[model samples]
Every structure is written in structure tokens, then in C-alpha cells.
Target chain A: MMTREKFEEAVLPPVVALLVAMLVGDALILLFGQSPGAVYRMLLEGTWGNAYGLGQVLYKATTLTFTGLAVAIGLRAGLFNIGAESQLAAGGFMAAVVGLAIPAGVPALLLLPVYFLAAALAGGAVGALPGWLKARFGAHEVITTIMLNFVVLALLNYLISSRFKVPDTLHTRELASGRLPRLDAFLPAFHGSAANVVLLLALAAAVLVGWFLFRTRAGFELRATGLQPAAAEYGGVKVGRVWWHAMAISGALAGIGGLNYVLGYKGYYEEGFATGAGFLGIAVALVGRSHPVGIVLAALLFATLSQGGLAVNALVPKQMVDVLQAVVIIAVATSVPEVRRLLRGFRRSNDA
Target chain B: MMALAFLTQTLRIAIPYLFAAAGGVMTERVGIIGLTLEGYMLGGAFGAAVGSLATGNPWIGLAAGALGGLVFALLYGLGAIRFRADQVVVGIAVNLLAIGLTRVLLRFLYDSSSNSPRVPGFNVTSSGSGFGALAQNPLVWMGFLALPLVAWILYRTPLGLRIRAVGEHPAAAISLGVPVTRVRWTAVALSGILAGLGGAYLALDQHQFTDQMTALRGFIALAATIFGRWDPKRVALACLLFAAAETLQIHLQGVGAFPSQFVEMIPYVLTIVALAGVVGRAVPPAALGRAPE
Candidate 1:
């Protein structure tokens, strides 16, 4: 029962932006004297054709979903939390510490919840610091978050290298408990892939976030504060309190991403493991238009490109994926209005 | 001799930040956010590298870097100013683009993902000690002159008046018959050129272009801009202060008492502390991030 106009309004810009991104990507591939069509086919086959590829794609998506949700939540509150990278590190670090600390005999059920809770709290605490700074001192969140990212990065490096490093290794000790079970072990089809039950948790979290944003009182206040702080303040909303809460939730979401990477896949927290996943969250949130459902689709698309980059490594520069991702974000940022106008023109012609 | 070494090293390190922070001041003072300064720096760095590599002339590299930064800045202005896209989003997007483009081009040209071959640079090492050493590098002298030049343009000129007017209140400026968009575009483009020059200094100083050679100096320059309260003179001094932190970190690491990571955190932690109003309040120009409607 969906109308064409509704579909056009809702979907056309991202679709066209993605197509533009692909076109730019193809041009880059051609510059290397490779056939763009063949390269793309290889990418598709490597990311989607096999069970292992799909599993890898989904596994990456699991982390993206958490980071995407983190940024999206911040965006909904009119805050740009560029420090998701730092929050993820904090979460992963906390999870690693707690996982290693638990006595060897702890049950998985109890240990897993404890691990997740510790991560969320640690990340939330890190996230709330920036929020408190902003609310108290009127400091811009963008700069503070960026500064915090470097602080976290340096802190993590110091901790790992000085105290937590296992002998000469660049990572902490492996966990004795709290590791999430792999989905492939039960499914068999996803064999050889690290895709795990954490993906289900990611999906469930997305649903819960959607519910929280659209169907809750705090959500209404938060959105109001974002849209118009003065108006929201006049409406009896505690704007500062909302910033603190929104940032805490946002950081908690990014923190949960740590569970996916550490407990779900790596089984230990390593320096540089989060890598650029935190930054990629910005693109995912932007492309998805800050919607929960849209974020999943966008995350999958980006994850495919990432997995495919590895697939096409022999044929093209691995940096091609970075180009495509950047192009997609730029294209979406620049071309959305034009796409909307073009769609409107087409719709008017049809009406005539 | 030790004090002279510290001073020269601090000046050398501060040059890039001074250029970037000045550029940021220009753009932000004209009512446009200069988050794209990061991208501009990267673009300039890559351009300078390629130009120097191709021509074997470091001066040509400097020109190419400015042009590269100008192009990137213009693109950013087209989106954020002309198209009225969200400024922060466009800035972040442009930064990512610069990273990807620079790396890909680096690979295509040098066949390596990490760094480029050493090119000819201004040999300031033989320029003697103290002020003579600083004068040996043409770029360093230019950076020093740039501070006063920017201050003059920002304060004493008619264009500066118009720019400040637009930034403070674009609608008011429009009512007074000023072309707000054109002024902002010019400010942004000029800012890019300056930032680009800063990037150029990185490659020329190191005599090679490495992946991410700017090393987030653009962001630090932004901190400098804030700490300086968007004043050219203050920002120049702030850049030196930050550079001092870097130099001190290096010295501390050489002493080996503290962990290297703790030293690395100095500038970043200070920026956070400063932004949190520990030292003083830093207010941005009104209407700075808004597009003219």
C-alpha cells in the first residue's frame, strides 16, 4: 500500500547517492587499468555469494550497528559525539579487564551479563564527561569529543604497553570467561566465520533504541531539546539533564559494540582493534539518515564494501573502499536536495 | 646552546600550526566553520609532495600545495555555503575524502602505502644557529610574516570590516548591501590556501610525504584558534605554546622517566582542559556555523 511519492521521498536520495558513489568508485578502479565490472562482480561474490562471506559481512555489521546507533542517538539530541571511537575503546578495555578478572568457574550466563554491563557503564562514564563539560561550561562537544579520542587512544596504549601487555605482545591477557558463543558453531552453514550471537543482540538493541526514541517521554524531551533548546526549555524540559542522559545512552551504545568485537569475535581486547570502526559510525549514521532501520541497511552496505575491499585486494588498491565510503558520504551530503527536486519534478510530470 | 635548540625546534614545530590556526580564524570569523581545515592541510600536503617529486623544485611544491588546498576548500564552500548542507557533516566528509584520496594517490605514484621518497627541500640546517637558522628556510620566514599580514588584513582593512559584519550578523550585512555569500566564499578559499601552505611545510620539513603526515595538526590548530580567541596574534602564540608541549614531550621521553604515551597526551589533554574553560572563556563569532538563508 505504499505510494510512489512516499517511496521517492523516503528512499531516492540515498539510492541515487549510493549510485553516484559506485560510479566514482568505478572510475577509480578503471584508473588502475582494471575492469570495473569484473571488480564489482568479485566484490559481490566475495561478500554475498558464500556463507563465509555473508557471515563476515554480518559480523562487521554488528559492530557498525552499535556505533551507528551511538552517533544517531547523539544526532537526535543535537550533539555530534565524534568520540564514539574513544567510548568503544573504553568499553572494550573494561570488558577485557572484567572478562579476565572473573574466577575460572563463573557461569556463562552470569559472566556475559556482567561483561556487557561493565562495558556499557565504562563507556557511558567516558561519554558523560564530555556532556558534563558541555552542559557546565558551554564547551562545544565536537572539539571536546575529538580531544577525548586522543586521550583514550593514548591511555589505552599506555595501559596495554605498561601494565596489561602479555609479555612482549601488544595486547592484554585473554579472557577466561564471558566470551559469546559463535553462531556458526550452531548453524554450520556459517562455518569458518566469526559471526556470533552478538549480531542478534545488535539487532535487538536496534529495535529497543527505535522504541526508546519514538515511544518514550524522555525521548520526546531529548528530541525537543535538540530541535529547539530555548523552546524545549520553555516547555519545562531540563536541557542540561537531557544532554547528560542522551550522551550517556549514546556512549553506552558504542560501548556495547565492544562486546561484539571482544567477547564475540577476538576473545581479547587488543590495541588498535577498534581501528576506524568509530569513525565509520559517522558515515553510517549520516547515510542511514539517523533511522534505526536505515542504519542496518547502510551498515550492511558499508560492511560489504569493507569485506569486498579485502576480496579485491589483489586486483585494486585497498584504499578504493575508503574512496567509495567517503564518496558516498559526500554524495549524500551534497546531492540529497538535488535528488529530492528531481524526484519531485518526475512526480509532477506523472500527475499531469 | 640547549636553549637555542629548544627555541628553534619550537619555532619549527609551531610553523604549521600557526598557518592552520590563522586560516581557521579567517574562515570562522567570516561566519563559516573551518572544520575542513584538516582536509585542506591533507590535500596541500599531498599536492606539495607530488609537485616536488615531479618538478624537483620545493618552491613549486609549495605552490601546488596551496592550489590543492584551495580546490578542496572551494568544494567545501560550495557544499556548506552555496548548497547549504550541514557544515559539520560536510567538513567531516571532506576530511575522509582527503584521507582516501591522498592514500590512493600516494600508492599510485610512489607504489607504497606508507611514505614517499625524499625530495629536495630548503636546507635550513646550514643556515647557522639562532635567527640565522630560522631565516634559512624560506617557509619559516613566510610563516612569521604571515601572522602580522593576517592580523593587518583582519583588523585594518575594509574587507575585514565586511567580513566581521557578515559573521556577526549576516542578515544585517545583507540589509547593508554586502554580498554575504561572496565574502564567505572568499574567506573560506583564502583559509584553505593558508592551511594548504601549512601542510606543504610538513612535507618540505621532513623532506618526504608520509601517510597522515599532518598528524592531526589541523585539529590542534583548531584548538589553537579557540585558545587564541580567534585572534591572529594570540593564535600565533597559542601555536607556539602547543609546539612547546610537543617539544617538551620529546625531551621528556628522551629522559625516560615517564611513559611515552603520557607525554603524547599532553597537547590533547590541555586542549580539552582549555575548551572546558579552565584558563578562560573562548566565545566564537556569532552566526559562525549558520548558512545565509
Candidate 2:
């Protein structure tokens, strides 16, 4: 089953895309008067080479994994859930609010579940809006979801600014309890980094998601709907219901993504925090080909580049990393199966 | 006087939306997604700033802005049209690249992080702060002209008919011997020119290019295109309506404690509502976002 050809088919496109993206990066670095090799080495030394740097990379990857899964699940149902950014913020706000609302006497066991549910519910609610819109009214999810990002963020901004923000600051009061422990508690080498048990939660979510998408009947329905909605409906799948459920589940995953930053690291939700992660998750999901295992790897690759951008900032602008990301997405988009088939001389008129 | 000021402010704000919406309507009508309107505006803004700074001529800056947007549109066209990549994803990529490339160019060309040096622009100080001042800005007049020009071209021209034909039925158009690819390419280029002028409007009016400027105005314009249901006259009305909302935002500042953030949400919220078919259905072109056969 695991033939060399199959393995190559699975791995070749992203590998090729990454190499090409790096070449583009090299040109940019050189344009800025820095040796690409030296800068890249410095990047590696700063991220994968050092334990602390690796921890930072993992921390960033944890958030990406959640949001990436959110995007991938919706993609499976033929929805472009572009509101992961909005959902993530809503989730963080809920987590922060829930953490603060619970009585201090409550056991950790009870409080943790409450916070998690609150975050998930908040994110799911936000995610469900666009889904419901699409299902009931034939609205396009892309436009609605993009609009929702601005709407939800502004709503949260109004709430935090007017009602909840600590005076003289843009963030709310820090949670006094239920904060997740840092990796330094056990992994002493990860000192000074924000890596934590949330990484375990993310990995667990990935495994669960992988199983749900590949093994379950509902997951099959979602995938089938994505492939051909009319045929899926013919086969007895309620395509609209799948759209709603997929988006809600996708949103719930993105909501928990916020816990990695809010509860695990910052213990509070700050305005504009995790701003780009939602967009970056789109890149991650696409690059990973919407696979769980692949998303983890893609997340790590991006995290390295992101953390390394800071490392190489003295030599080249950190924005170079953003450029490389765009190039990578472009390369990946150009090579996806549909385009590949077109390039392979498939004729539109040929039914076979 | 206050009403006149409000009208002038609304008109000034409407200029960019008008230009960018025209661009959005153009590309989408020809079947390419108009997601890159934001990116084009940004490209034009930076290009206009650099041109004006180097040459001290606003007209030259305007041309540079158009060229910059054209370059981005071509890049997007290469990805979406030539490679037949997912149109939405390719559009997002170009937006990302535009932001990154602009930032890099900002630092490389000017060595500043937040803004470029102030440039010469069309806003003439001698004309005072009323309609006369607004009139002196040539771009504003062009902005006012945008909807009518597009409407006439779309309804009355052979090329527009071809564009509509390709969008609605590319296969039939191919059978009819129309060059579908060339028509789309031309349409996208035209979109770039229109949107590039919109971005130039922002830079020329502000007299500087700030970091990551254009700040979601392009999305609002895209929303206008949707809110108008892709009709030129309706889209112009949508643009004016959103521009008025923005104008009201400034006037409502600290009045009755209305949060400016809520006002900012008006356009996006309305667009989503329209898309939800609370209003009539907002349909796209039949061939929109389809991969080439």
C-alpha cells in the first residue's frame, strides 16, 4: 500500500513549492544586501537549533494547527470559512470571560471544562452565522465570512473597550485561576518559552479530527458533498445541513485555538492579539493539502519561518517571511490536482 | 454650510469606493473574482507616492499608480488565468504579496517603516475647503465619472457584450470563436487600471502613503459591488450609501455616544444581509471561479 510512487505523489508538490518559495526568499534577502545562506543558517540556528527557539516554534504551531484544522474541515464540506480570525477572537473572549466569571471555589476539573465549552461555543456561534446564511439563503460563504471577521472583531472591541478593559490598557483583567502551565514545569530546557500543555490538546485534536474525517460516515458525507453537491444530495446527504455542521465544527476548533494564547500563554485576551494566525491558517491548510498530519508539518514550517524572521531581522526585513509565505501559497495553488489535470492535457469535452 | 461640508466629505470618500467598485464590477463581470481590489489599491497608493515624490508632479504620480496596479493585476492574471489556480486563493496570495512587497519597497526605497515622504498632490490649498477645493481635485471628477463611464461601456460596447458572453458561457463563446482568455486578460487589466486610480486618489488626497494604507476600503468597495448585485447604477448607489455612512461616522463622533466602531461595521453588515437574500439574491457570473477546460 505504501509504494514509493504513492509516497512521492503525497510529498512532492509541497516540497517543490517550499524550495521554490525559499528561492524567492533568497532573492529578496540578497536584494536587501544579505547572504541568503548566512541568513538561512542564522534562521535555523535561531529556531530548530536551540531548545528555547524550538519551544517558541511549537507554541506558534499550536495555534496554527487549530486554525488550520478549522479551515480544512470546512474545505471538506466545500465551504471557505474565512472567518477563522473572527472565530478565534470570539473564542478567546469567551475563554477570558468564562475564566473570570467562575467562582474561585470551583474545582479545576469543573472550571477547565466550563472554560473550554465557553470558548468552543462562542467560536461555533460565530462560525455558524455564515454557514446558516449559506444554507438557508444560497449566500456565498466567502463574502459573509470575510465580513464577519470585521463585524465580530468590532463587536469584541466595543465590548472590551467599553465594559471589560482594565483601565489605561487595551486588554482585560488577567484570569486569576485556571491558567495552563508552561512547558518549563517539566521540560526545563524550554525555559523562557510559552510552550505548554495546550500543544498536547492541539495534537489530540488533530488525531481526533483525522479519525473523524477519514473514518466516520458524517465525514464521508462532508467530503462527498464537497466533491459533488448535487450527487451527494442524490445519495441522501442533506448538503445544507452538512454545510452548517461543518462550519460550526470548524469554528469550534478555531475557538479552542485561542486557548493556546489566552489561557496557556497570556492568560488574557488583548486587542489585535493573534491577528494574522487566522489568515496564516488558510496558508497552512492549503499547503498541507488539508491533511491533519501534513498540517502539523506545515504549521511547523511556517512557525520556523515566522520565528526565524525575527532572528534574521538584523540582516533583512522580517517582512521577507511574509513574502515567502505568499510565494509558497501561489506555488501550491498553481500545482493543486485540478490545475495539474488541466496541465496534463485533459479535454473538457471528454466524458471519460 | 455643515450640510455642504458633509456632502463634500461624503463625495471625497465616495471617490475611492467608486473607482474600486468599478474595478471590482469589471473583473467579476468578466468571470475573475474581484478579491484583489484591496491589493490593487495598495499598489497604486504606493506607486503614486513614489512617482510624485520623485518627480513633483501629481499627474505623473497618477500614471505610476495605474502602472503599479496593472503589474499586480497581471501577476494575479498569470496565476488565476494562466495557471488556472483557484481564483479566490490566488487573489488572496496577490493581496498578501502586495502588502509584503509594498512594505519591503517602502523600506528599501525610502528607508522608513511607517510612511513615505509627503508628496505633491491634486488637493489645491488655494481653492478653500468647500466644493471648489473638491472640484480642483481632478481625480474626484474622474471618480464621479466612473459609474457612468462603466455603465455606458458595459451596456453599449461590443467588447462589453463579449465580456458578458464569456462570463456567462465560456464554452459557447469559444464555439463562437471569441478569444476567451484574451477578453478576460483585458478585463483584468482594465480592473487594475480603474482600481489603481482609486488607490492614487487616496495617496493624492492624503499626500502620503502610510504603511498598510487602504485599510479595508477595498473590501468595502467589493462589498459595494456585491450590494449593487453587480449592476453599475446600483453599485454606484451602494458606493454613495456606504460613503454617506462613513461621513455620518465622522459627524456622529462623540454625539449621543455612538461608537464609531459600530458605524464602521455598517457596510460589511449590510453586505452580508444582502448576500443572505434578506434583499434580492446576489448571484455571480456563471463561469466565475471555474478552472479552464
Candidate 3:
């Protein structure tokens, strides 16, 4: 029932919230006895100060982009998929297994697809459980997904410490001979950097997701189910199917997020390597208003903050970064009502 | 001997969760699903530690912990009831805020991150033998004793009727002249007090406090609230079930039966299985997460 104009109107609130959050964050920096102007300069400098920093920023952004998309997809379907962390862990573990198990004689081109597929399958299966339960039994996904997160974490911890433990290290075995090619080798011009072609793939995935959600019939059905399930069912939409499909797709997206980590940065699975990406993905999805393009922008912005946050640790406590992220999420969530009121007021004023 | 040890361990682990879940049932019965139970518990633990450390009196710490819970519950009530914020989002925010604020305060107060100084233990005495072989913390006994009392308050009291009425049908209750908002707020605040006391027990009973010590207990309490089907008696039973699982894991570890990591995973895994099976038909309050119009 949201017209194009109304959708645009809905978009303005998150944007304003982001601006206000930034202002508040800057104020917080000042309260911490740091110069806001200098901090901003340092943030930009840290993120884009040089080639290495930019590469790290892009590298971090690539993983976040996928996770953000995963969360956004679930949000669109009215599901709060907090299990992305566990799904990512599962996917990363599986991908590491696949990457290591492949025959050394195999070509990189052939093995890459296998690694990606395995990760996607593992993550998708993890996601499917809560999705199926929600669809079949009307169970709340939030509680089940969170519980599953713990289950997955425990399972991963067991595997890494026991069966999958590399002989010498606390992580899995090094990736097989035929795995994702090194980013430096793939892009000769960007020598000695973590930035890879994965960024492009992430961008392409975002575009495809955007088109799918905005243009396709399935997307329309999913949105309809989310906005008003009763009405969607009345319109002959299979609400359960949409929920299942959306969650499956959401899981796959989160799985790819795990894939990005292995394929781009670490190239191996380490226990507890993903600190809080899945949870942070929730904040990203919320800040972006569950739109693919918005998610991409938000992910990049967060990636910059995270990267810059590390560089400014000497001047400010690292916890400040978390404070900023928390502020943004709180501001956006709390501003929704005000935004609606503002929009209604504007409309009334225009009519008057 | 093993069984006795297990029973004692289970009581110790279950007491905090029992208090929290009892509180959760009270709030949920009033139509507000409290997600910040963990935060309140953590606040209580920290507050108790700080107060006892400063005052050299464990009782004062207990009171301070309850006060901390009261303050947090008030914030949640204001946001969810007064401002009509999304309950779940507010819950998540409260949790994150608790994490950030706790860390900040720890650094400010203790100058360290790991553990606080030990305090005087709670008062308790063990006696008898055989079935009574298990000596219990006085707080543990109090937690158990509170169950029937809570059940009484929920089912036998006039205030309980008003609370249930508001939860079930706010408009109808309001039409009947019940102060719906006041009842809901009271339920929330009372839940906070219980959760806070649970947290205080963690510090005062255990004789120490540590960062993240109440890890995920709040979530477990919420799960217990659901598993109990929003009934005080059932919730206490659920808490005991979860606590038994935790106690079994600890016992297995004490005897070196399995790797500690594997033992630690039992509670989480069992919770998932329990949710999938026993929690299948649990119905939450009809308007549990909704804001009053």
C-alpha cells in the first residue's frame, strides 16, 4: 500500500537519524576531551590515509556488505535473523573444510566454486531450521535463531578444538592449493593489499538483490507478506512459502558474508574470528531501513568507522566506536515515530 | 555423594534463574515481555559488588542491586509504556546500553576488567543427612520459597487479578476502572526487583563479581518465562530444569568426564532442543509486545 512517494518519505527519516547520530557522536568525542575536528580528520585519514588503510577498509567493508544484505533480506520479510553470526560461523567452518579437502591437483577456478557452494549450503541449512520452524509451527524466529546461535557457536568451538584443529595452530588447516586466488595476484595494480575483486562481487550482489526486491513478483509477494500477512493471504499469496524462501535467501546471503571473510581476508577459519559481525549486521539492516542500496551505504559507513576507530585508539578509547554505533541504532529506532509525525505535519501544512 | 553434590550445585545455579524467571512471569503476565532481565541482573551483580566493597556490608549490596534493577526497569517501563517505543528494540538497546555502561563503570570504579574483590558470603547453615545431605545457600532456599508466594500473588490476590486483567485486556480493565498503566508499571518494576535480587545473589552469595558473570542468564530467564507458559509455578519448574542441565554439565566437568568446552555447551544445546519440543505450544500474552494506544 506504500506508494513510491510514500516510500521516499519513509526513506527520509533514517537519513535524518543518521545525520543526527553523527552530530551526537561528534559531541560525544568532544565530551571525551578530544577535538571533534581533529578526530574526523583522523578518521578520514585512517580510512583513506594511504593505500594500505584503504585496502583494509575495503576488505572489512566487503564482509559487512554481505552480512548487511543478509540481515536486510530478513528484515524485508519481517524476520529478525540474529542467527547470522552462527550461520556465518557454520559457513566459514564448512568452507574451510571444503577449501582444505579439495585435491591439490585441482585448478583454482574449479575449487573456488566448490568452496563457495559448500559455504552457502552450510549457512543456508542453518538458516532454514528457524525459517522452517517459523513457517510450520508459527514459532518466533528471534528466540529460536538466538538459541541456535549458541548451539552453532558451541558446535564450532568443538570442531575447531577437536576434529578440525590444524596440527600446529588453533585454527583450521590452511586453504587448499586450489582456492580463491590471492587478491594481489588477481589485481596486479593493487599490489601488497587486501582489497580484492570481492568488492565488485558484493556490489553486484547488492544490485541483483535490489532488483529482485523491487522488480520481481516474488519480491512483491515477500514484501506483501511482511507488511500485512493477513491481507497477503487474502490476496492468495502463500505466506509460508514467502517466509521460507525469504529466510533461505537470507541465510544464503549471510553465508556469502562468511565466504567473503575466507575468500578475501583470512583465507582460513579461526575460532571466534568473527567478533560481532552478525549482531552488527542487525544494526546495519536497521540503519539502512532494510534496503539493499541503503544496506550497502550503511555497511561502508560502518566499515569506515570501524577502521577509523582502530586508528584513533591512541586518542580515544576503542569503546567510543561502539558508543557511536549504538547511538546510531538508538537514534534511528527512536526517530521513526517522530519522522512519521513530521511527515504527517508536512502533508497537513501543504494542504493548508 | 554424587547425587547430593549435583542437587546442591543445581540449587546454587537455579536460584538466580528462578528469581529472574519468576520476575519475568510477573511482567509477562502484565503483558510486557521483559528482555532486559539480563541487564538488570548484571546491574544487580555489579551494584552489589560495589556496594559491599565500599560498605563492608553484604546486605547493603543486596539493597543496592535491587535499586539498580529498579532504575533499569523504570527506564524500560518508560520507553515501552510511556513513549510507545518498540519493545524488542528497546530491550536490545537496553542490553547494549547495559554492556557499554557496565564496562564504563567497571573501568571507572574497579580499575580492572576481570574480577572484583570478594565480599562476605550470604548467611546459610547446612544440617541433617541423606535427602538433606545437600546444604543450600540461604538465598537458594529463599528463591524456592518465593515460588509458592509468587503463585499466590498471581492467582490468589486482588492485585494479581488487576495485573492479569490489564495484561489480558487493557481497555476492558480500564473501563472497569483498573489503573492499567500503573499495574503494568508495577509488574515491570517488581520484575526488576526480583531480577536485581538474583544478580545480587550472584555476588553476595558467591562472594565475588566478575564482568559478564551473568552471561546470557537473562536470555535463559526469558526462555524460562516462555517455557513456563507465563505461569509462575511453571516458570520455576523450567528454571529448575535449566539449572539441572547446567549443574550436570558442571558435575561432568568436575569429574573430568568430558572437555570443559563440550560440557559448557550442554545447557545451550539442551535449551534449543527444549524450545523445539517442549516450547512448541507455548502461547505468550495476547498483547505481550504491543504498546498501549
Which candidate has the top score in lDDT?
2
- Model 2 docking category: medium
Off by over 4 Å in 3: A1-12, A15-41, A167-169, A178-195, B117-138, B145-149, B174-179, B254-280
Best candidate, TM-score-wise?
2
Question: TM-score, chain A, per candidate?
Answer: 0.95, 0.94, 0.92
Tell me each candidate's i-RMS in Å.
Answer: 1.6, 1.2, 2.3
> How high is the CA lDDT of each candidate model?
0.86, 0.89, 0.77
**Model 2 regions more than 4 Å off:** A1-7, A105-109, A337-339, A342-352, B126-128
lDDT by residue (tens digit), candidate 1, B1-293: 77887888889889998888888999999988878888899999888988998999999999999987898899899888877877877888888889888888888889989999996777665544465767788999788876677788889998888889988999999999999988998889989999999999888878898888888889888878877888888888888988887888777876887787776676677778877878887788888787687
Which residue ranges in model 1 land beyond 4 Å of their true spot? A1-7, A337-352, B125-133
* DockQ-derived CAPRI band for the predicted complex in model 1: medium
Residue-level lDDT tens digits of model 2 in A222-256: 99999999999999999999999999999999999
Listed in order, the DockQ scores are 0.67, 0.75, 0.40
In candidate 3, which residue pairs get closer than 3 Å at backbone N, Cα or C atoms, i.e. clash?
none
lDDT tens string, model 1, A115-207? 889999988988998998999988888878888888888999898888888987888887887788888889899998978998998999899
Query: Mind giving the per-residue lDDT tens digits that candidate 3 earns over A24-49?
Result: 66776776678988888888897788
State the fnat of model 3: 0.25
Worst 10 residues of 2 chain B by lDDT: B122-131
Lowest summed lDDT window (length 10), candidate 1 chain A? A1-10
Q: Give the candidate order by descending lDDT.
A: 2, 1, 3
The best-first sequence of candidates by DockQ reads 2, 1, 3
Docking class of 3: acceptable
| Cα RMSD to the true fold for all candidates | 2.1, 2.4, 3.5
